[model samples]
Target chain A: MKAVLEIFQNVHMALYAIVFILSLIKYPVYKNTSLKFLPLIFLLTLVAESMGMFINKVYESPNSVIYNIYYFFYFTFFFYLFMKVINVKKYKNYIKIGIVIFWLFYLRDLFFTDIFNESFIESYIVGAGLLIYCIILYYISILQSSKVLVIKNDLLFWISVGLFLFYIGYLPIKIIRSWFYKENSFFWILLIIQFSLVIVMYLCFLTGFLWMKKKS
Target chain B: MDEKEIIIIAAIAIPISLVIIVIVLFSVFARRKNRMLQEQEEAKKVFDRELAESQIEIREETLRNISWELHDNIGQLMTLAKIQAQMAQEKPEMMTEVSETIGTGIDELRALSKLINPEALKSLSLKEAVSLEIERFNRLKFIEAKLTINGSVMPIEANTQIILFRILQEFFSNTIKHSKASTLKVVLNYSEEELSITAEDNGVGFDKSDDFLGIGLKNMKTRAQLINSTLRIDSEEGKGTALTLKYKFV
Candidate 1:
C-alpha cells in the first residue's frame, strides 16, 4: 500500500515537472495579455507545491511552520494562476475584492487561531472559503466564455464543468473530515478524487488552449 | 520519490501527459490549416477585386456608348431640324408652325445631350460646374433651386470634376423623382486641406431605420470611396435631407 502511494506521488511530481517545462516553452506563443501571465504563475505554483510536498514528507504532524508557509504560497499561486487564465473584465474588481478578503481571512486565522481560543473548525472554514471562491471563479469562467472570442463553446463548457467538479471534490475532504473524523481510508480516497479532478482540469485547459488558434 | 509514489504518479501523469501532447499537436495542425485557409482567402479577395474592376469597366463602356449616341444621332437630328426651320421661313403660311415645332425639338435635343455628358463642365472647376448645373435647374418650370460658392475655386483634377458632376446629376434626379421638394440648395466650399460639398432640400424624407439602398446613392458612395472622400447624410421623416462630401487632401 505504501508502495502504491509512493508511485502516485512520483507520477504527480513527474507530470508537474513536464507541464512546467512545456509551459515555459509555450508562453511566448500566446500573445494575449491574460494568457501571457499564466505560465509564470504556474511555474511559481509548481515550485511552491514541490517545496510543500518535501515538507509534508519530512514532517509527521500538520503543525510544521515551513509546511504551512509553503502550503499558503501554493494555494495563493494556484489562485493567481487560475485568475490569469480566465479572461473576464466584469470580474476584475471582484478578484481584487476577493484577494483582499482572503488575505484578511488568512491573517486572522494565523494570528487568532493558536494564540486565542480557537476551534478545530478553523481549517474547515478556510476550505469552505476556498470552495466558495472556486465556485465563483467557475461561474465567472462560464460567463466569460461568451465574451472570449477565441474559445470554443464546448471547450468552455468542459472547463467550467471541470472547475465545478474540482469544487465538489473539495467538499468531501472538507466537510466529512471535520464532521465525521473518518479513517485514513477516506483521506486517501479524497486525495485520489482530487488528483483525478486536477487531471480533468488540465485536460480542459489543454483543449481550450488548442482551440484558440483556430478561432481567428 | 519511492516505488509506491512512482506508480501512483504514473497513473495520474500518463493521462495528463497524453492530453497535453494531443493539445500541442492540435495547435500545430490547426495553425498549418489556418495558414492554408488564409492563403485561400487572399486568393478569393484578389479574384473579387478583379471581378469588381471588370464590372466598373462595363459600366464605363455603357456610358461611353450613350455619349456617342447623343453626340452623333441626336446632334445630327437637331442640325436637320434647324435647317428645316430656316427653309420653312422662305414661305409665309407654314413658317410659324414649322418654326415652333423645330424650336421645341432643338431644346429637347440640347437637354438630352447635357444629360448624357455635361460638356460645359470640361473647362470649369467643380464650383463653376455646380454653378452651371444650378443655372440649368432654375430654367426648369417647378424647381426653386439655389447655388452658393463659399470660397475661391481650388485647382482640382479633371477626372474628379467629372465624378462630382455625375454625383450632382444623381442628386438632382433623386430630388426630381422621389423628394416632393420645392427648394434645393447646392453649396461648394474649397480650402487647401479639403474640398466639401453640401446639397440640401426641403422634402418629404423617408424612414432611414429601414435598409434603403438607392443605386444612384450607392454609385456615388463608391465614387467617393475611390477618391478617399467621406459621405454623410442627415434626414428626418417629413423634414428634409442633407448630403455632405468631404475630400481628404493627403
Candidate 2:
C-alpha cells in the first residue's frame, strides 16, 4: 500500500517538474494578466505540496508556518487572477466582502473552538468551503465568457473542473474517516488521490496559459 | 486545534490568497505594456503622413522652378532668334528659308516650353489654357479634344492658378496614359456662386467608386485636397470617364 502511495507521489512530483518548466517558459512570453500568473501560482502550490510531504514524513516540522503562508498566497492569487480575467469590476466589492468573510472563518477556526480537533469535521468543512468557492469561481468564469473583450478558451474551464473534482474527491476522506482512521493504507490512498488531482489542475492551468499566449 | 484540522484549514487558505495576489500584479503590468504598444503605433502613423506630405511639397516646388526657368530663359532665346531671322530677310531665297524655318522653330519652341511649364496660368486664364490644350490635342490625328468656356474668365490668385493648373495636368496626364479614348472634352464655367472645371474623356473609363486606390487617382485626390476642391471621377470599364473639379471662387 505504501509502495502504491510512493508511486503516485513520484508521478505527482514528475508532473509538477514538467509543469514548472512549461510554466517558466510560458510566463516570460505571456508576461501579464491572470493567465500568466496562474502558472506561477501552480508552481508555488507544487513546491508547497512537496515541502508538505517532506515535513510530514521526515522533519515532523512543527506544522510549518511556511506551509500555511504558501497556501494563503496560492488561494488569494488564484481567486484574484480569475476575477481580473473575467473583468468583474462591478463585483469587486463582492470580492472584498468575500475576503473578509474568509478571514473571519479562518480566525474562527484558528482561535475560537476545539472544532479543529475533530479531524473529519475539520477536513470536511475546509474541503466544502474550497468546493463552494471553486463553484463560485467557475460561475464567474462562465459569466466572464459572455462579453469577453479579450482572450477566451476552454482550458480555464478544464482547470476549474479539475479543482471542482479535487474538492469532491476531498469529501470522501472526511465522510469515510471513521472507517479509515489511523489506517496508513487509507491515508496513502487519500494522499495519492489528492496529489494526482494537483497534477491535473497544474496541467490544466498550463494549457490555459499556452492558449492565451498563442492568441496574443 | 489538532494537526489534521490545522493542516486542512491552511491548505485552503494558502493557495487561494497566493493566486489572487499574483494575478492582480500581472494584470497591471500587462495593461501598462499594451498602452506603450498603442502609443508607438500612433507615432508611426503620424511619421508616415508627415513624410508623404513633405515629398509632395518638394515635387510641387521643383515643378514651379522648372516652369519659371523655361519662361525666363527659353522664351527669351526664341524671341532673339525670331528677331535675328527677320533681319536676315534681304536675300529672297535665304529670306524665305530663314523666315519659314525661324517661324516654325519659334512655334515648336513655344510648344515645347508650354509642355515644360504649365505656362503663366493666371495671365493665360483657365479658359485660354483649355483652348490652347484642346487645339494642341486636335492637331493629333488619333484623338480629338474639344473645349468650351461658358462664362467670362474670373481673375484668380496666382497661387491658386498654379495649383489648379497642376491638378488639370495630372488629370489629363492620366487620361493620356490610361485612356485609349478617341475624344476628350473640357468645359470651364462660372456662376455667381462657383467656378467649375469638367473634363470628360470617351476613352477607356475606370470605376472611380472602388475603395482601393490607384496611385494616379490618389495623387489627383491629394492635389484636390490641398486646394480644398471637390473632385469626382465617374467611369466604367469601356464607357468613358468624366472628372469634375469645383471650388468656391470667393
Candidate 3:
C-alpha cells in the first residue's frame, strides 16, 4: 500500500514536470500569454511539493503550511489562466470578482481563523471557484460558437475539460478529508482516485499542448 | 449505515453524478453545433442554386430581347436600305442617302452586338448597363425613357450587380409588356453608404393589394433578399408603378 501511494505521488509529480517542460517548448512557438505563465506555475508546484515531502520525511509531521502556500499559487495561476481564456467581457469581470472573493476568504482562514490547521478550506473554495469557471467557459464556448467542429483539437475545450474533471472529482474528497483521512483503506482509495483524476487531467493538458495547433 | 460509510458512499455518488452530467452536456452541445453547421451548409447550397437559376433566366431574357430587336427593327431597316440602294443606281445623287441609311443600320447592329456579348454584359457596371437599356428604349421609340443619375457612381460587387440587374430587368419587362405607359423614368441615387434605385412609369397601373403577387414581384423580392437589398413597390388603380431598391455597400 505504501509502495502504491509512493508510486502514485511520483507519477503525479512526473506528469507535472512533463507538462512544465512541454509548456517551455510550446511557449516560444505559440507566443501565447496564457501559456507563458504555465511553466512557472508548474515549477512552483514542483518546488512546493518537494519542500512538503522533505519536511514530512525529516520532521514526521504533515506539511500543511507548504500546501497552504501552494494552494495560494495554484489559485493565482489558474485565476490568471481563466481570465485570459474566458471570451465574454462580462464573464471576465465575474471571474475577477470571484477570484477576489476567494482570496479574501482564503487569506482570512489562513491568518485569523485556522492558523495551524490542515483544514483544506482554501482547496475547497479554489476547487469550487475553478469548477464554476470551467463550466462557464464550456457554456460560453458552446453558446457563442457556431460550430465546435473539432472540439478535441480545441485548446480551450481541452483545458476546460481537464480543469473540470480534476476540480469536480476531487472537490468532495477535499471537503470530507478531515473525516475520511482517518480510515486507512478509504484514504488509500481516495488517494488512488485523486491520482487517477490528476493523471487524466495532465494527459488532457498534454494532448492540448502537443496536438492542438495555433488557430490561424 | 454509519455516518462514515454514508459519507464515503455520498462522496463516490456525487462525483460520478457530476461526471455523468458533464458528459451529457458536452454531447448535447456537440449535437446542436453539428446541426447548426448542417443547416448553414444547406442554406448556402440553396442560395447557390437560386443564383445559378437567376443567371440562366437573365441570359434567356436577354436573348429573347435581342431576337425581337433584330426581327422588328434591324430587319426593317436593312430592307429599306436595300430598296434605297436599288434606286441609287439610277440616281447617283441619292447614293449618299443610301449610304447614310446603311450606316444607320450598321450602328443599330453594333448597339445590338453589345447586348449579345456575354463578357461585355458581365463586365458592365450597373450604371452603364441601365443606361444601355434606356438608350435601347429611346432608339426603338418604344417610350419616352429617361435615366437620371443623382450622385457620383460607385462600383458594386459583380454578383450583387448581376442579381440587381436581373431584378431591374424583371421590373422593366413588366412595365413594357403589361403597363401601357408612355414615359418611363429611372433614378440612380448614390449616397455615402448606400445606393438607391427608383424606377417609375406613367402607366395604367393596377390595384396594389390585388396585384401584390402579380408578375415577377415575388422573385424580385427573393433576389433582393439574397443580395441583402430592400425593395419597395408602390402603385394604385391609376397611379404609375414605382419600384425603389436600396442596397447598402458592404
Q: All models, DockQ values?
A: 0.04, 0.02, 0.22
- Per-residue lDDT for A182-211 in model 2, tens only? 754335544655666566666665666567
Candidate 1 TM-score for chain A: 0.67
Largest DockQ belongs to which candidate? Answer: 3
- Per-residue accuracy of model 1 over A1-216 as CA lDDT, tens digit each: 567667766766665666566656655556454445556645665676676677567854343354345445645554564566556755545555666666677677687666223333454356446645754674546443433233344333344444545544554444544554445543565466556666666666555444544223
Local error of candidate 2 at residue A93 (angstroms):
3.4
lDDT of 2 by residue, B100-133 (tens): 6567656766665665453354367656656765
* Model 3 misplaced regions, further than 4 Å: A27-130, A133-137, A178-185, B1-3, B18-26, B71-91, B119-250
Give the lowest summed-lDDT range of ten residues in model 3 chain A. Answer: A114-123
- Best first by lDDT, ranked: 3, 2, 1
Q: Give interface RMSD for all predictions.
A: 9.6, 9.6, 2.7
- Where does model 1 sit among the CAPRI classes? incorrect
Q: Which stretches of candidate 1 lie over 4 Å from their true place?
A: A59-97, A114-164, A180-185, A203-216, B1-176, B180-239, B242-250
lDDT score, candidate 3, position B38: 88
Q: Which docking category, incorrect, acceptable, medium or high, applies to candidate 3?
A: incorrect
lDDT of 1 by residue, B154-245 (tens): 77776655666666666766776688888999888878888898999898866778454366677778767666688877788788778899
Which candidate, 1 or 3, would have the higher DockQ against the true structure? 3
Which clashing pairs does model 3 show?
none
lDDT (Cα, tens digit) per residue for candidate 3, span B5-68: 8567856885677679678867887787878788879878867886897799888988888888
Q: lDDT of each prediction vs. the true structure?
A: 0.60, 0.61, 0.79
